[model samples]
Target: MRLRRRTFLQGTAAATAAGLYAPAVLAQAKFKVAGIHASPVENAWNSRLHGAMQEAAAEGKIDYVFSEGVSGTDYGRAMRDYCEQGVDLVVGEAYAVESEAREIAGQYPDVGFLMGSSSGPAGENFGTFGTWNHEAAYLAGMLAAPMSQSGVFGAVGAIPIPEVNMLINGFRAGVTRVRPDAKHLIGFIGTFFDPPKAREAGLAQIDAGADILFGERIGTADAAKERGIKAIGSLIDYTPRYPETVFANAMWYFSPLLMAAVADKQAGTPTGRDYTPYCLMKEGGNDIEFAPDMVPEDAIGPMEEVRAAIKAGTFEVPVDMSEPT
Candidate 1:
């Protein structure tokens, strides 16, 4: 009876240890994040979010899954499915399904929702952010001003949405800062992922004597490359793809914002806050990149002055969301 009692005690202790170990292991499981893209992952805007999530996952920060080519009409459904799957956070563009997305967030109050939106946050978890790359776009335009041989710059945008307008306006504002008489020809393709339409609009602008094309959309570089003129790229670097055609790029980095959201989730204090400030230059959200050999030597100094001022919080890039006519 003594030996049996000792054996039973040892067995009970081992089972208790096993139970505790299992719980500890489960507690260390990575957070699951899901992204739903309105366009392909390769698209300009989605790529930023996709790349950020990829980087985070690679660094063992979170377990990330994404579904691309989700349309506006299907956005709410995607959100619901992901929420039902018990994802910790959902990230995507919510400009189209703002109302529906907010309603879904209300249903899943435990899960955090962060999206690219023009409006404010909703409830406790529906956070919103902007594309706030206007500062970088301004620098891109400054670089393009000297390259414009015809004194005419062309900007091709996905839509006349507030953020889109703000970005284009920033670029034009930078250009006119240098060349006061510079004329701009602008067009909106009415869709976000239609590169062919963007290219067509760019071609029209080029035909109208637009010497430097500001490609807020992807295919504008094709027009610039074909026309043998300089162009400015948005969201991603097109210089590698277009060689000498794309001289500068207005880049938006989403990693800082993602990490912030992850931190909030880990702290269990996630809130429906506007994360737009995380998209600013000082916050490592956006910046400009240019091929040193492509940009004129004279344009570098002024652009750097503005860049420095932006980082130093002295010079402010105006956010003009009014429709750019």
Candidate 2:
């Protein structure tokens, strides 16, 4: 009888150890996270946002509500919809609906608001964050300058905003570092999702002696591929689609950053600041990736050297975007 009782107690103990009877088990339920994008998932930036959400979900059960391709009036409505649904966190890119989001956040003070933006939030209930994407852009420019046979580079930008301008300036800096005389031809597409317009601008730059291109919009890389020029991709790597044409890509990892914010808010230490979370080689925020199949084997060694130097603080690439064009 004692042995039987011991066995039963051991079983109970094992179950308790496995959290089968913990009251907090039910209390620690999965939270819902909603992401509202300024553009569709077909674009790299939005796709990365979705990817981050998925990654967070895999770690813990997270229900994701995505409102993709939303802008202006629709964006505000979408925020309201997420709040009405009683989601724990509403994550969105605030570049398009900054003011509208701020107004909506004012109404739903309980809901946590996190934005991927260059601008900051006006209230304590909201927080804004963006990656220091300029570092990756500069690295991409470094790759392009040496590989460009035409001695010219091109950038297809979405808008003239500071975010886009910084990337253009970073790319120019990278090229200038290696090839100081290299000329950069830039085009602003005005809209982030306009693929045809972005393509046209890319082609025009190519015609103007830009043999190497950095693509920002949805179809900019496609334009570079069609023109038989090498392209550096932004936000996410597109080398899988155009192995030969895409030389390198600047990748963004937004999942960990967003999850950190959500966890902080849940812990009651919410940061009410509009800050650019620039990821460098040390922080693992942003990094450059080369096409495994297309990039020349000999170039990899030197690139790794530069990457390591940057990470080690020995090689500081000039990041000043205010330099005169």
Candidate 3:
């Protein structure tokens, strides 16, 4: 759902009615939000954050300003700059400069720091969130299993981090769900934005008889398109660019996380907590999208069943952080 100001405020009011916060908290609806992104706006991860903030700003929930392409060495300075500028909420990913970012956040108790970190939040004012899309990746894997023509699948990831590893492992498990005999060919491009390197790695997988590819990075879809094979998307939907070659996608929606952070800040409770619940499947954080013409007709029914099971809490997709071989 599009998180307009009205809907967000309504949700906040409903939460207050449920006693999550006092009724007076609704007065703090508007916030001055600033983002310090480590990557460019075109990068999928950063794009999600920037896009959601833009939507919130359009709705008048926040007066948003952001800085992109921030280097790891300068992340703390950028964050401090925002705090010094009297920004109420500072949002960004601190995966590379986790300790430094958290330390800077400690300096500003009045500012709400919602950062993307591999660990939990720090200090009284620092909070954290992540994509947490492993379950959705597993769902994508279930779709990929029966779609594989060569009985071999490949995944091209940006790195071997826990977040990346969980997606790959989840996809592998999903593939095993339907095609237990399926073989996985995995490769990491070492960086998030290198399409050429990702393409090279994906092409090598295709050469090894892998017909279905997981484009965890941006450029793996190019390899799949070149091979005329179906591919899976990550973080955001890529079907518009590769409508025929891309079948299923694991999408990480940022609106829910951002909206939750706003509500917490309004209620004066946004601090020292991990906001990952907003990124879970149950909270509309992560999801899978299937193209009707691309996915096998028979596979769609079971995939829906798995999706429903996930939301209903009948099934749990385990998170595996070990590097995929």
Q: Give me the runs in candidate 1 sitting further than 4 Å from their true place.
A: 1-28
List, residue by residue over 1-325, the lDDT tens digit for candidate 3: 7799999999888986764342124324457889998888888888989999999999988878899999998888899887776778899988899888888888898889888999888888899986788889999999889887789999999889888998899999999999999999999888877899999999999999999999899889999999889899999899998888888899998888888887888789856788988888988999998788877889889989999999998999988989999
Give Cα-based local distance difference scores for all models: 0.89, 0.76, 0.88
Can you write out model 1's per-residue Cα lDDT over 1-325, one digit (the tens) per residue?
A: 4669889999999998885565334335878889999888888788899999999999988888889999888889999988777788999988788888899999999899888887899888988898889999999998888888899999999879888899999999999999999999999998877888989999999999999999999999899888898899988888899997998999999998988887887798765998999989999999998998988899999999999999999999999999998
TM-score of each model, paired residue for residue: 0.89, 0.83, 0.89
The superposed Cα distance between candidate 1 and the true structure at residue 6, in angstroms, equals 47
* Regions of candidate 2 where Cα sits further than 4 Å from its true position: 1-28, 296-298, 313-317, 320-325
**Who is ahead in TM-score, 2 or 3?**
3
Top-scoring candidate (lDDT): 1
Worst 10 residues of 1 by lDDT: 19-28
Report lDDT (Cα) of residue 247, candidate 2.
82
Query: In model 3, which runs have C-alpha deviations exceeding 4 angstroms?
Result: 1-29
Clashing pairs in 3: none
Count of residue pairs whose backbone atoms collide, per candidate: 0, 1, 0
